[model samples]
Target: MKIVVAKTAGFCMGVRRAVDMVLDASNLSQEPIYTYGPLIHNPQVLEMLEEKKIFRIDTIPEKGSGIVLIRAHGVPPEDEKALKDAGFTVINATCPRVVRVQVIIRKYAQKGYSTLIIGDQKHPEVVGLLGYAKGNGHTITSMAQLLALPRFKAAVVVAQTTQDTAFYDEIKVWCKTHAPHYKIFDTICGSTEKRQSEIRRLARENDAVIVVGGKQSGNTKRLAQIASMAGKLVTHIEDASQIDYKTLSSARSVAITAGASTPNWIINDACSKIETNLQKLHPIKAALFLLRDFLLKTNIMAAAGAGFLTYACSVLQQTAQSFHHALIAMLYVLSMQIINNLFTIKSDKYNHPQRALFYKKNRTYLWVLAVISGGAGLYLSFITGMLSFVILLVMSLLGLSYNLKLVPIISKKGQIARIKDIPGSKTILITLAWGTVTCLLPAVANHSDLMPVAVIFLFAAGLVFARTAFFDILAIQGDRITGKETLPILLGEKKSFDIIKYALIFNIGIIFLTVFTDLLVKRAFFLAFIPFIMLLLISFFEKDNLISGAHKEFIIESSFLATGLIAAVI
Candidate 1:
């Protein structure tokens, strides 16, 4: 079955702002952080926040300390003032869109104009908006209510931001005919309008539509309402486990959309669940999918790629014909990759859902395996020489500390932090580490000439740099949403791509240059084509959405495997 996901199916600008603020606060603040309410309607996010020790307070205490954030749904001006007056450092995380509506209402209310709000009468946003109306606030849900209210000499009409556009249009029509002089502002959020319209299109084109979000979420529920109105089979689910395969089994195609407050992880989980369930009916296909996931999830494919690159690099450096160095490289890479994945599961939750789940479920086993592999690699390095042992030992310690807090209280206020917090550090550090293990360590082991080894190191590091940065580009969306300042996020996607492209070209040139100058054997030249092929594949994937998710990752990783194959033949 084919599955389509809406581009706008995750967190809207406002919710994302609030979530990012909270996450940033989590890392920076010494005081306990609290939100005025659940940060957003999505339960998963709220739960995650709770796990991070960011609590929520439904009612204001007479006195409070630490920091408190207003949720995405704006609160009354007085409530905000009270929170600050109570001595808590207040960060207003209210949606800018909602803040605009409040400013309008407050401006008009001060002029003695009655304010009419169009939305659910009880929603937090509407209630907060009502606060700005001073005593002249009124809310109406429908045209009947609008028609029943007495006409005002002068008033302004606005919406709850997430209000239904069509319903608001009808309200506007009633106001135009009944009271033409009243001011009107279409305060419904543009994102809400786009989401509603997109769901309508999705419903029309697919056999079934799945609306993924909190049932309590107004915007999420409206999406379901719109899909139902379009006469499509609709399922409203909060997460993946709630998906009913029996209902979706007959459908040949499905469209998945999530509410504005929904996070990407939930959307991915729901899609993965559906795909998994659908594949289960055919044992052969199910087995294949399982194997593919296993290879990628366990880091086996990545390890194989590392081994292959080590072989190619060894050949380029004219190293001895022992596989010990190659084996050490593979084990070192495998250990680091697993440990890194375990540390980065939060971002992986968005970039690679299945791999995130794999790490989540097998964390203990994976941790043990990483320790064992790392130990074995270090043992082999010891066998090589004292220098090799010390280098690998120091590298392993640095690897272990990569995610640990290295700089304490660099800021005026102390906070838990690490080298990972440094922008663009991940790509550079991984490239250096991989180059050391795959290129530098091997040369040290073989006692090779410094000049050729240096050239080979550049070639290896350049390719690894290009590959890592490209993956960073592909994951920019999730990285940006999660507030990770990766290389692509810091430099922007287009510039990052240009850098990767040029770096690949440079790597190709160097490979050929080494061969032509008789610095390396003729067979080493073929390895240059490996990166050339990768450059073409990346360009193809970028030009057209030719591949995505696991498939794209598998094929890119296979490029390194292909390097090993070409080297073996030559």
Candidate 2:
């Protein structure tokens, strides 16, 4: 059995330094030693340290006489002060890269550059950087939100040491646009870039790739994402023992990569297991595996299309008046065909063959479903009333325009493409559509007063904008890669983040005004608004990732649906 290891395997500089510092302090310390947190990301390493009588403490103990080591992820200044005040002997194992972030932040603050740290606010490194800035720096996670900030002069941009390099570049460009004089310090560690690039290269070449690291380690998770983008079979694992041998039984070649904190032994153990499993598979079985993979991919596409159409039906039913209104519904269905075609054309040449195939295979059935439904909808609307028919026609056009030739006209002209590419467009469009369909479509079809309709549209627009901006923050990378100019890409991460902040503030203001204007039933509507506020709070802390993005959409959609249901009942 042969084992191949990635060139960048094992503990990185920060992890190495932190581990060594802890061991050295343990050797010399007389009192029982403790780490402020896990000294490194790897649980194996922490377990070993615990065996040696080293332990973790969240805060300085009451007696506080033991040697207290700070983790590679530096602690906030106030916490460090509290530890020192408690009479603990402190050993600072803070990574050099993280230290640089602290220095840069302090420098910017001293120079009066209204400093901004573009990173996760809850992250230890980010928390430390903020403390070092001493209340002068604002933390931003995306560029679109940053642009909406009250204009600041002499802004200096820095990132969390583990942040994506491309995101850092996007933030720099955004600051250049909004700030009078902007300075960017590329503070991301070189090891992170090297590891990410290496994983991408491996994923492109390998049949399958395993990214081994702690789930909580940001850098390791990024390596997994790079592998996913290359369209390789990637599994992220915390240790060698967690590897599912059954999944790799037929794999001929598998590449292994680890995060900054992963130990060399773990990588080696996983590789050995992979080779042992492959040896047990026969040639015929391997061929069977490939066939199984193909069938699974095909089934997945069919299932997805069916699911989407079902959801669209539910949405239409909620908005439309009667079963006879199915003709207008048919148009809505037809519009989906146009969207599917546009996506197929745009994505066919991408490296992910599975995605292209999925779109192509399901497109025919999707189109048929759309056309039949749309045609039926139009005929029913005409039979019912001219006004209802017109509304259906307009909606069908809007849906088609979003993805087909009509929307491409905006893309080709550059102005509209640029605007849509801006971070907030998708969120803005989806939310607005939901709100409009829920509030206005029913009234217009029934010839109700326009005043209530106008109020609903306005209120819905505000909430939708808030929700969409947050999702845009999550999709910054996809938008950048696909050349879909979004707020995060155009304005940079920090600026884009500030824009979301301002948007939320404005949204809250509008909600208050609507309350005073009696647009909402004071108590019932306000109670419903509580969930949205909670969603906003959750979005603030969300890490920019696919799971978080999905979660954000789920929360926003639920809020929209709940608000609509509550309003309808009232």
Candidate 3:
């Protein structure tokens, strides 16, 4: 079986903008936050917001407090004034396309034009549009209803932003022939149009179509309606659990698409479940997938990568007993990475659902592993040398304190009580820690000369920084919702990617340069290929997303093992 996912699936621009606004507001202030109604039609998102303590108010009280955001579907002009009159600070998160329709209706209503809104009468957006029409408003859902209305002397036609484009088109044709004097405006949102168009093609090409979204969403329902009209088997589900796999098992190919309000995680989860169910994998393939997932979820792959990179760095610097340093690096990284994932469960819930579940179930065992690994690393460093031991101890203390409140005397107005609150701190701290374990500790232990040590440290730190920042770019959505000001969120994804690519390029250059300066063996040039490969992977993943989340991570972690391979070959 094969699965084809529509690229247009998932949250549209207006939905994304609204979600970002609400999340940003929740992150920045302690005020009681509320959306005027459900933020979007998706139940999962509504549950997440409630979990974050950002609730919604369906009604306006005589006196309100804190902040309340207008829904993405928007509300009437009078309701906006009422919320302000009720003493709530209003943030208009109304979809811009919906706002455009409101503007059109308001402009013409003042000129005594009856507004003919082509949409479901009870839908939120259409109701909002009706408000702008004052007393001169008529909503028609069918051609019969459109014909039943008296031909107004003066009228303006508009649509609900998510209205069915084909139905709206039919209305336009009828208006053109029967009421040539009436004015019609093309108001269906571009996002909606593209989604409908794509679904038509997918329905024709695939054996079955799976539409994921809230049933309440007008656009989502329309997608299912359209797919069924295409004469293919269709299943409209809210999430992965609703999928009726037995019915779909007969299909050779399936196309998956989601509504504008549906989130990426939900779609990803559904796709993963569907694909796995259909595949019924062979034993070897199943084992490989499980092993890869286990290594990533336990942070073992990442720690092993650190160990390999440390060994390669040790070789470049001509250190004695490089294996001891590699063991230390692996232990320290395993400990810190485990603790980091534990504390980041909130973000992980969105960014990595499977890992989040694993951590939640194995929380106690993970804590024990962190303690054992951290203690073992310190003992190894102590036997190596006093300087290395001291350095590792201080680094461990900092790692432990990363999520803890270390800054004192913070007032309620200031949320900067933890080191994690500082923007871009995660990437910076991760780089320094990795560099210290992989490069600085080895140098200090062996008493390497200062110049060569500095060069090796730069090479290690550059790669570490690039790796951390690249993952941050991937997790920006989850981080923003969970209120973590990571490097990508601070500088934006494009800028961060540019910086990461540059850092990787610089690492390759410096590692190669070390050979010319007599700082490293000639074989150091081969080790330079590690960062160059990473640069290519990052570049490729950015342009195309052929790889799934887990497989992509496995390949990236495997890149570090390449360094060890090259070192062994030489």
Candidate 4:
């Protein structure tokens, strides 16, 4: 059987050193052997030790001068004292990289600098490092955590051996700005960095990447995350035996990488299984993958398009009271779909092939729906009056221009396809269009005053700009990858976050203005403001994950509903 192995495999320098120390002590000592933990994360290696009569004890077992092997993770200073006091022969197998972190913390602490460790606080390595420090130290998991710490006169920062380098740098910058004096020691292990860099290179070169390691291993999880960041589909596995044949069947090129502790033998076994299994894939499975990909993209586009349309309709209904006005408002929504489809053709072909396939298969059906919906809306506007029809026509043209010509200009310059790509472009065009056709167009057709319509536009403009900024921040990464110049990407993450912070402040200002003008009641709006504030707080903390996008959408939509309910009651 042929086998393929990753370049980086088996025990790393640190793990090898630790394991050798344990084995050497077991052979030389006359006492019964025991370890503080499994020694390393690999189950096979731990089982092999058990077969050789090695055992484990959480604390020094009562009764004899037995040998106790410290795990690669290392233990706190207090635990080391307890073992020494118990009269057991202590065999130290702690990884050198972890020990260096403890030394750095202690050195800084003794010099009167507050120590800060950036990683998961619950990890044994962090806990051990904390024990070496004399004074109260802080453990920061995210940028938001930095806000809760008191201003320190001087600080020393160190990272977990396997934490992402970029995240560490971000924390370092924050500390420098907030503390009087700050020192950063980059303690991430070289072996872990080499493995992660190799995985990133593999992900960029291949259609998909597979990372094999124990699920509970921190380094293994980091490897998978790094691959995903490079825009590759990554599947993390415990061993080669866990390879999902179905996932690999259609992959044209697959790159495989493994964590430091994974053995070469297991990697070879998995590659063999993948090659053999891929050769026998049925036609039905291929068809299913194609079908699933098409449905997923279409669903995403449809959902986004529908959300834009719904917001347009709601803004219109606030000032318009006639059925004819609502119908004209729907025409602008129809035009937006037609426009988005026209500009997305190339992107859908390259980055999203499945969506391109769907468009090819259903272009005629989609175009026909666009025509019917748009024509019906125009006819409703005509029935109300000639002026209403002209206004609806202009709004339709503006919506079409967003995707038809404007988006193409940005795309040629390699920018993300959004109207806001043009700096200082007011959403006033879209917002006014929505508010006029939906609210004022009908009111005019019914011969009513336009004061209510003017007030509605003012409120819609502020909300529209806020929503645009929120989305830009959320899509910053995708925009950067595609070479689109958006506010967030141009400003960087910290500055972008600051901009959003101010945008929220501006939104509150608008609410105050509305109250003074008596367009909206302060009491009713403030009632809904409670949830909005909660949502903003959640968004601040959840900025680092995909869940943040979902949370933001939920909060925005809920706020809209709550505000509408309050309006109805008033």
Candidate 5:
């Protein structure tokens, strides 16, 4: 079965902003952090926040302390003032779109205008908006409620940010005819319009549609309502576990979408589950998917890529007998990556669920594998030379201690025990380590000249740095939840991507320069495409709608294998 995910399926701008602000407050401060209400409509997010000790309070306390954030659904003017008066530092994390609607209401309410809102009467956003209406507000959910009201001498009409587009259009047309003097503003969020329209089109095209989001989410439910209006099979589920495969077994194609408040992890989990179940009918696609996911989860694909990269770098330096060094790189990478994964299960619970479960189930065997591969790497380096042996030994020990508590010091916030506790250490260390194993070790084995060795090391490190930073971007959501200060998290996603792009472009330029100057073999010119292709892939992610899951991860790891193929062919 063919599966398609809608581009606008996760975290519209406002919810993302609110969530980020709250999370940042939680991670960077030692004070108690609270939201005035649940951060968003998504239950999973609220649960995760709770786990992180970011609590929510419904009422303003008589004497509050620490910090409190306004939810994405903006609060009343009075509520905002009260929270501040209660001695709590308030951060308004309200969606700017919702704030726009509030501004429109407040502007007209001062002129004795009645505010007519086309949305659910009890919705939090509508309630917040009404707070700005100065007591002359009326919520009209249907044509009857809208027509029953007296045509006011002066009134302003607005729809809830998540109001149904078709319904709101009807409201506008009716109000324009009946109350010609009334001002009508397009208050429905642009995101809501796109999502509704897209779901309608997707529902019409696909055999079945699965809407993944909180059932109580207004926009999410409206999406289901729209899809169901198309007369197709539609399931509105909170997560993957709620899906009923027996109900959807006959469908040949499925369309997946999520609400604006929904996070990528939940949507991805749903997509993964559905794809896994549906792919069983196609043996070839199913087999390939299983194989790819296995390699990704086990870190085997990463290890193989390391081996291939080592071989390519060796050939670039004109080193003799590159296979053994490639093996050493592979073993070192396999052992290090496995150990890293084992220690990162907390973040993996939100980043890569399947891999977390796999690690837990095979903990003992994986430990055995890591120890053996690391030992084998040491043995190979020892056989090569004393310098190689010492370097590999030091690198391996550092890798092993990365997740271990060496400082044994506890602070007011928590223990800054492990090397991983140091912010932005992972990306830099991984790049340096990969470069050492792939290029520097081989140069040492053959006593290659410094200029070529240094240039080749830069080439290898540049690609590995891009790879690490790119994955960090993909896993930013989980990393934030787990309080990880990755390069992407510290620099922000856009800046990190900018850095990755510049790095890749630089690598490409270096490759061409070396090839043109005859400093490296002509086959090394093919290596330029590695970074080039990666740049294009990163561009796809920058589109801001692609799902970061197994498929993207598999393709990225395969880029390393491309290096091996290029080396072997020449």
Candidate 6:
């Protein structure tokens, strides 16, 4: 079975802003934080906010304290003033598109024109838009209602930011024919229009459509309603648990989409659940899927890649094959990667739903395994030599402290924290660690010359850096939400990709240059081509729309296996 995910399925710009605002407030505010209402219509997001102690207040308190954020659906100006008057700090997170509608209404209202809003009257966005009309606002959901209304001498028409485009267009036709003198503005948000358009295309292409979002969200419900009009089997589910496997199993292809307020994690979960259910229908496919998932979840593929990289680096140093060094590299990376995943599961909730669930379910067992692997790796390092053991031990300690708060807090406002908090540190640290273990540690144990090993270290680090940064680019949304300062987030996606591209090109160039100069073994030059191949694969994955997330990950990880294969052959 084929599963297609809409590119515009998850949170849109406005919803993302609201969520980021609330999360930042929760993280930075010393005082309790409260949103004037539920930040968005998604219940899963509300639960997450509640978990962070960011509550919602439906009513304005007599004496408010701490910070109160305006919802994504803008509230009335008076309510905002009331919150301020009640002694609460207000951070308005209203969608800028909605604000544009408000501004249009206010501007025309000042000229004595009444306001006509095309949307559900009770929606928070419409309610807020109404406040800008200065007592001359009316709402109609359909053309018949607009036809029944008394004709206005002068009026401005607008839409709730998430209003249906076709319905609003029909209203536009009615007004053009029946009330030509009235002013009309297309206030439906661009993001909303794009999402609706994408879903329509998805519905046409797939046998089954799954809409994931909050049931109460107006835009979400409208998506389901519109999808139903396509006559395809459509399922509107709040999360993965509600998926209708019976319906999904019979379909040849399925399309997954989500409302503007939905997060990537929810959409990812829904997709993963459907795929898992479909896999169970065939024993061979199920086994293969399980094996692939197991290898990824346990970081075994990544560890194998590390082992391969170690082999390549050793060849560069003109050293004989050392399975012991490779094994140590594999175990050390597996330990650190698992522990890092354990700490980063929050971001993974959005970035990698299946891995997040795996870590959650087997938390204790995985932690124990990480500790044992780390200890065994260190023991093997000690057997290799005192220098290898000390270096590995120090790196292990640094890895363990990556997420721990290390900086002292001098005051309430002054606190330096975890190494993870440092801007663009994740990619750099990961690259350095991988380079040290795979190249430097082994080189030191073998008593190789410092200069040659340093050159080899740069080559190894460049490969890992490109890989880590590319994943970070794919995971930008989740990392931003979880307040991680990864390289992609700090530098932006396009720049990060450009950096990765150049880094890959540089690695390839250096490797070829060394080979031509006879600075290292001729066989090692073949390993350099590995990054060039990876560059092509990564470039292709970015450009291809049909490639699934799992396929992309597997292909990227498999790129490193070429190193081991070529080293063994040569």
Best by TM-score: 5
Better of 5 and 6 by TM-score: 5
Candidate 3 differs from the real structure by a C-alpha RMSD in angstroms, to one decimal, of 2.9
lDDT of 1 by residue, 46-130 (tens): 7767767899999888899999999888999999999998889999999999999999999999999999999887899998999
Residues forming the 10-long window of minimal summed lDDT in candidate 3: 407-416
Give one digit per residue, the lDDT tens place, for model 5 in 1-570: 888889889889898889889998987788999999888888878888998999999998899999999988898899999999999999999899999999999999999999999888889899899999999999999999988999899999999999999999998888778788999999999999999999999999999999988878989999999999999999999988888888898999999999998888788777877888778778888787778778888889999999999999998898987999999999999999999899888777776777888999999999999999999999999999999999998888778767886545354458467767778888998999999999999999999989888888998899899988988887787787778889998999999999999999999999889876767877788889989998998888778554536667777788889988888887
| Residue 2 local lDDT, model 1 | 69
User: Which candidate leads the pack in lDDT?
Assistant: 5
Better of 3 and 4 by TM-score: 3
The RMSD of every model to the true structure, in order and in angstroms, is 4.4, 21.8, 2.9, 21.4, 1.9, 2.8
Model 6 score (lDDT): 0.84
lDDT value for model 2: 0.61
Cα lDDT, all candidates: 0.83, 0.61, 0.86, 0.60, 0.88, 0.84
- Which residue segments of model 4 deviate by more than 4 Å? 1-6, 60-64, 279-570
- The candidate with the higher TM-score, 2 or 5, is 5
Preferred candidate (TM-score higher): 3 or 6: 6
Q: lDDT per residue, candidate 2, 1-570, as tens digits?
A: 223457776678887778767766775466888999777777766666776789999756666687898888898788888888899888889998888888887877887777778888888788888887767777787776676566776777788888877778788876666563777888888988777777777787777888888888778888888788888788899865677777764556678888888764455445544444454465664454344334323332222222232222223234345333322432443344345443644432222233345557777865665566667656766775777678767766655555545544444335554223334455555555544443444556666556545654555455555555655554443333334455565666667566666665665565566566654445433533633473466455443221222234444444544543444444
- TM-scores, one per candidate: 0.82, 0.48, 0.90, 0.47, 0.96, 0.91
Better candidate number, 4 or 5, judged by lDDT: 5
- Candidate 1, residue 430: Cα displacement in angstroms equals 2.2
